[model samples]
Target: MSPNVKSNLRVASASGSVTDRRHAFADLAKNEDVHFIVGDWMSEYNMTTRGGGKVDSNGGSEEFETSFTEAFLPALPYLESKNIKVAVNAGASDTKKLYDLVVREIRARELNLNVAWVGGDEIFDVVKKAAADGSDFRSLTTGKLLSEWECDPIYAQCYLGGFGIAEAFKRGANIVLCGRVADASPTIGCAAYYFGWKREEFDKLAHAFVAGHFIECSTYVTGGNFSGFKSLPSPALSLGFPIVEMEASGEFEVTMQQDRDGIVTVETCKAQLLYEIQGPYYYNSDVVAILDKIKIKQVGTNRVRVTNVGSIKPPPTTKVGLTAKGGFQAEAHYFVCGLDIEEKAAMLESQVRVALDETKYHCLKFRVNGRCPEDPYTQDAATVDVRIFAQSRDESALSINNFFRPVTDTIMQSYPGATFAVDARQAIAKPYYEYWVTLLPQSSVKHVCYIPSKGLEISIPPPTDTQDFLYEQETYETNAPIDLTALNPTTRAPLGNVVHARSGDKGSDCNVGFFVRNADEWDWLRSLLTVEKVRTLLGGDDTGKPIFRFELPNIWAVHFLLKDHLDRGVASSSTYDVLGKNLAEYLRSKWVDIPNKFLDRGRI
Candidate 1:
């Protein structure tokens, strides 16, 4: 560590994703009193390709996230004027390409900023060669081999650690562009560089990782997408960006400006911490965070102190994501209004199945999205959509004549009040990507940091120390059978009346995390909310899917991880909630018997 360690470092999270506020970086540099800024632009939901492949809303051209150009171009001079350091993974598929774009702009502006780009994220060709050598590429979620996948793999991008970013900062690079680095890596890199922490400094590195995780989503830690969003006086859309005031001891505080919207409290911090995490052990390429013992408390208005985060060495394997064409999918909706909704949906599904010759396609399904009320006032309320969806490898099966004609031709034959919620023009088959999450050895990554001004490329090797991570989650149960009658003064109501939840997708797996407001409710939560109870709450939709339960006692939370729940994942999911974001709300809506005493305390 440095002799004169940085007393305090102020770091801000600029943009959460491609769709986040375009003026975030500029606004921060011009208005905020921060020394460093980081942004994460890559997401599993959006698939970007290298070279002349995909160039659309999903991703940017030149093999990187071009959407960042407009957002960043105006912020460059502001960065020069304010002298703030930046690190972002906006170089989606191509790091060098985006690096050149930034360098050209810097040259034109005559700014003193030294630019750098990180490499080793793109490993498509390497994996392809390894697959040919009879190496196993089994999925982390399904345990299915890559050979078993029906489609050909097009791209593979590995998530790198923060060491490369640290090296870039050490090499005098004022601005760094990265490809597919982990979301929290930016914060970790900034803190490591500022505080002179080594890669083996597991405790400090892990603490930085937690801070990175909290603020990486920009407004997430600032009340955006919160279950208690209505409690905030300001609208959820106008949330202030997050800031982490980190100290040399690895202690940090999460807060945002009060002038803007959003609140930074213990609950919002806990909510963001639990988002997208599968278990108590949160992994990164550099370090693994032991989250069960972490502490978060409100120190002042819009400020929360976080401490006691535990850590261990990184795992030998890192997460690798590959995108492949999963054939074509299309959907058409027929509205069944008024009475006989079930019979109408059933009749239409049976008619369409035969008409479309569903046997020719990979999979065809008829699903009733919403229910028609028994006695409704409006036609919309009395309507339910019977969706006819199909996926097929053979393009002919999804063609307009074959796929569209079958559903449209059945209008006259369908039951009463049959109409199309989806039009004919939108029913044409569109290509979707299937994202696969798998583990790759860290040794496979030849991580490097390139500083263009200095003409230097520093090799950042993989960590030597690692622990064999246990994928299993912690389990807690009653030692003996207890009397349900003792606490039996209960009332049947929606679980949301007493609990709050946040759910998100992780490839084929879905995590629905539920929490309470205080420790009093925590006792009732951990006892009553079990895997079996959660399965029942899912209403048999998960079927035979395995649901794993775990608890975060410090946060008064219980998490349920459902394996293979999203089928092929968000990009190619057949379900209506493609990202599985609504799973939490769905679980919250399920009826649960709450004790009258606990109910009297006030709802979450």
Candidate 2:
């Protein structure tokens, strides 16, 4: 049977985590009209940690293969009954192994499911050759060349697009597995395949791109991990994964399973849209999506329609993630409570400095968490955790027993109310990785889809319109501040009291975007929140880092990007919020002047 080109394409995301979400996948299986199901089982942290290990001959990791078996085998019967095609990037480091596993499971059940695998995103050899040829693989975060890196990369993988998966579906495959493709690529591929969208349909592709981005994180657009959780429906535990009803004209409606415990509204859709986006131009390997003019409207109960998405030319190069063994890291935490907490913390720090030599470690940090209240109601209120962490290339320097003995020796002579947070001996040293993100030419990547039954292999090439690799930094002039005296009365409150924000990490940098509910608030937001204002809000966290601010008029949002703020990315960063997930909440807690007029209009 030929696939329909004019019908609405219904694509749903089943799982978002690296581990199995049996309930979510079950929810997907129960749906009747879902044309396709997608899952994202890989994250940047997962790539750096689990993806660094050795690969078997079939190019699969034991960890991901186990996860795939546990998550998918149970749902296979249901998926086959529904005749739903599956597209997932769960293969991670090993697509072939996953493909083989799926085929074996289907054959044992006497099912006729056609499984395909997409490969060639792995580019360790290409990166090696480029580095050897004196190619300056400059770091996207630090601007340092690859040659300057101290550690050798264990693996390097470029992000592939969805066209290859689309090709696999075109060749009559029921399941398509991929490695290291963009998270949204699965939805993009499914939509393109169903709608017969041409490669040159930039506008349609842009719409699918945004739709894919929204649902890519599974329940994100359906109220999971949302800031306004209180505003959502009750029983958020059984939140449903997202589904997009994509039209042939590039418009889509975001919805979720009616039986689930989540709601889809304009607020949730807007929040997910702002998550992890850098600026107006969101660059994907296939298309550069323009987000400044995006529009979201609540069309019905638990349904939001997104439209007006734009796109520019696709970049010639895709981002390559390189993970290398950094060194061993170890840390221990101590608690100081009751009166004179600051004095006690200082005394403990002094004792540690005198007991241990700082020169033995490559990186050392003494961080204090929680503030000592001036007038405490309880001991816990006045307690603060002091953590000491050290990392080094030398294994002995980070050893649990040797490195902590000096700190333990001071317990007898330590300050008042000093105590270890937990058993100090439980702290163990473990190897970490340095994430080096750079760009690789798209042409250097070989994208191929393999269909075992048909004994076919298809090659997917880069788009002909691909341009040369270019990095253009967007610059915006600071808009003049609104005259508070000239306007109506105002009240001093936390910026979040009147604004909605979402934040995420991009390598070592963090991006925080603030959106307003109405035009009046947007005027105030655009005028009030500048790069300088953002730095002020960040306070000591800013550390004089380079900050860039951009304005999106259509969404009434302001976005700020702070560079080198997350230390050395998630894997090697010593900070508690390594992924920068809490950065927006922290900013929302900072007080800002809000115009009384906007607040009176129920903008908050």
Candidate 3:
């Protein structure tokens, strides 16, 4: 253990996103003896729609997460009584508003709780001026210049680190709200402040960063988004929020409430560790976490211990997301029932294509989802959905009459057993935002901590000792490649029968990570699940997209990153699986030859 810390610091997760259950903070405050309650409220897509972001064009009432405000207010007295602090990025855009509102509430309640906020995340005007000054705004993904982008930029926000939050806590603030500090930074700030950790404590800091990430999604580490859903009781029940007990030694234990229906295991922890990461190097403004040598294991019931998380200095540049008006989109679904599913879908698509002015729209697509079995027992099972999805920059081109009716009008003239799903909700074109993530020099960010009690806005200095390296994954080869011919009898089965996976979207790219329970299967898994295999499993979605694959042998897992998978960001995506949440399930469903012996061992 680091000599500076005397005991373990307990940090509990309160909320995952803006829409996550509000009872989390109160529940944790009433039940757990935690020093800090940290949670994240923002997703990349959330910014595109919420206040002070893309919504600037459209009038927004409050311009912050009001639901989270309600959740935090009720827990204030309990938190103050227990001397528990809160560190969160719930200040989606306007931290000043959030700070004022929170401070008002605290004073109104006659509570002595102090309030602080971190800002300088908003850099819309700065970026615009820099861009106009001939500074290259190149795309991190395609390496194309920002000038080439069809969409005009409106808002730009840099991802801040935890230093500001740490400063807030150090300055005697009970609550630290942030705008766009990286999601896990709240946990990093809490652990750092409690341990009195310095900037040079990369190893310890990296572990806290990962620990924050594990429980950042609240119940994710507690088997909420876990692949072994069926293995736990009450799989569909609302899970208890996660709490991480951190030590100065850079090790932490993840666990949830005993009464709630959620399980904390090694598998669940691994699942969250692999989620939404672009590569092995997790870049943060404070410290870049290296997951290559990380270790996780179930130490006790409802407890999983994570250790040995490696780290390097912060990347000189951090992610900066810029959002712009992408335009409008609307879709109408037509359910074709019973026989001739393919023929009916083809006929509908052909008619819809001719009826709609494809040239006027940015993307006009007809997608056919699912299929009717040779003889489906029920009507629901026998139906297939044919969707006419439309997107256009011009509002007039995507009006209900232009976009919706063109597809719905063709229903009577085309296909049999045609019942279309179109209503006032789906008929109108809703505006969407295009999001792009790129790297900006950390020096450019004006990140600061505002301590209301002290009336100070202390600017945080970017790390001086930083490394410059391409964000990449290193392949792990712990054992010799398995010879398929010598393996157990092969059977055609869903890959999920043995391998379990977790998949999520990071910007336009998708990350899918697969793991196994048995140690022996680790070698086979790394050797079997390659980039080519991932591409093949993805089918049309692959489309020669660049894929980065790596192995996490310590966790018995192989991870694949499919780039440019989502058609732009989720806010403007035309794909049905906009968030790529189902990528793992879709990949697992693909028939693959698996060893009978492993199958006999039972599926994940």
Candidate 4:
């Protein structure tokens, strides 16, 4: 390990979607100087869905792994020529399988790439034994025990850190495949291995950790899913993925391919920094990243430097995402247009209820989307989608054709201009599952790195200390209220006009973080957006739900976590905004008073 020479580790995110993004892989592979290329292809929902079939039987499926291999095969020659190392957690439930496939492909092509697989993230047997031994496996969202779970889990896997990936790289493995390491583990692992960052180098590790967090979702920090996407100079469709250039001092600059579309500015970086994080302290298996004191600056045309990252102690336990076959769900959508949209939806609901047996389903919901225009100027303006969703434990009762037949049958006699959104036959019942997110003792997980070429296996241990590093909530004094009457003139505009926000979901809960561009606007933002004010912004959505507000004075940001906001998370949620990606935009659309002085500064 060379500590004297500062390493400029350039890592790029190749894939970010749950499914295959072969184009992204091809795009990142074009950069010959990239040392590490990472891809994130797993999510809790997809894990359960992909693992539903029999393991070793005729019905067994490895479609997820197969899709990745097919998409990634195109970049093999380029990667080998450039000697670029690849790290990805595309192996949702089967890392070994993916490793074998890659090795086979390399041998078939006569390539010299060394492949490795990191496992031990899967803890199904451990969890099963614990359950039999009367372990509660309490729910993180609701404090209820796992004993109350309606069905047995499909599988249980813990979130491992970057050490295992680092070990693989240390063992001379050029391409490392992982099962369920933290999303940023590949980037962190590569950086750690290249710079020889020890466990004790918490500050340096924390900076890499934050950098990993920023680019884990690929183009998210590059204006792909940004709230101010409309104002961005580049078109969102062809946006470039993020690349991080890490310095030994722990500071890093986030940039993207020059030929690709997208801009990396302070606003975009700050927006992604606040994405999905709970509070000032962000926890991972490797270290607790204290992000309250971080700073962002646009140093170049498309480069933003993130510095001053601090760290606290690591956690004693790692989080385990448990998925169980909850039940079967079937849904159908009917488009309603013209006058009395609400009346048309209610009438359709009444007719469907009389036709279908309600007792056969365990859960049922009817949701109406969009609104009828007072004076229609376009066909879309007068249209609203009415969806009927039904879930049941008995598969036969929730059969697609049988469950949705009632809705389809009524189309002939329903309200005027009523029709199905798509082919009604496409409404098929499929298995939906509940995601139980809980923590497991770090010592229980055995992380191993295996290099197939040398047949070498290395064991990665957890932190020596077992003390919990759970962050103690800090008490923040609220800023004094601003005298709105003192301002000369105020314009009633959307909060998003001056305030930029980023929001995402954490299982059943969701967090939305708001930040300002200027320091003077920070005071007004802080004073204007109190807990009460935020609750008002949520409108009826906050009914009976708990909302906690946090302030990060150093970064001039205020974050709020809405509990149980997402019905049952992404997979099973009946809500249209499954991942809560639109929650910030929804809040931003709400009108609020903005000071004329702040607006005059060209912050529109």
Say which candidate scores most in lDDT: 3
Better of 1 and 4 by TM-score: 1
Q: Record all residue pairs in model 4 with backbone atoms less than 3 Å apart, i.e. clashing.
A: none
In angstroms, the error of model 4 at 41 is 1.0
Model 4 ranges off by over 4 Å: 1-4, 54-59, 234-237, 400-402, 410-416, 466-477, 600-604
Provide the global lDDT of candidate 1 against the true structure: 0.83
User: Model 2's lDDT to the true fold?
Assistant: 0.82
lDDT of 3 by residue, 1-604 (tens): 1225688988999988888999989989988888889988898887766633435645445567787887898898899889899999888777788899999898999999889999999888778778888897767665567888888877888899888988888888989988888999998888878888899899889999999899899998888877788898765587889999988877999998768988898989989998888788888888989887889988999999999898999888888888888888878889998888889999998888888888888888788899889778898998888877888888898887887778788878888877888464776887888888777888888888999689898999988899984755564433576786567679999998888899999788888899999997777787787777777887877769678877777898888887778878687888888888889989988888888889998777
What overall lDDT goes with each candidate model? 0.83, 0.82, 0.84, 0.81
lDDT of 4 by residue, 1-604 (tens): 3323565888998777676457778667866468889988877677666555433233355534566776688889888888888999988787887788888899999988999999998888888887788777776665567888677887788899998999888888889998888888898898889888888788888899999998998888888777767777745558888899999877899999767778888888888888888777888888888887888888999899999888876888888888877788888999988899889999999988888888988788889988987899998888899989888888888675578677688888888887986776536877788787788888889899998689788889998754485533443536676776666488998888888899998778788999988898787887888778888998977855667677776677888877778887887888889888889989988998888988787654
Q: What C-alpha lDDT does candidate 4 achieve relative to the native structure?
A: 0.81
Model 3 sits at a Cα RMSD from the real structure of: 2.0
- Most TM-score-accurate candidate: 3
What is the full ranking by lDDT, best candidate first? Answer: 3, 1, 2, 4
TM-score for each model: 0.95, 0.95, 0.97, 0.94
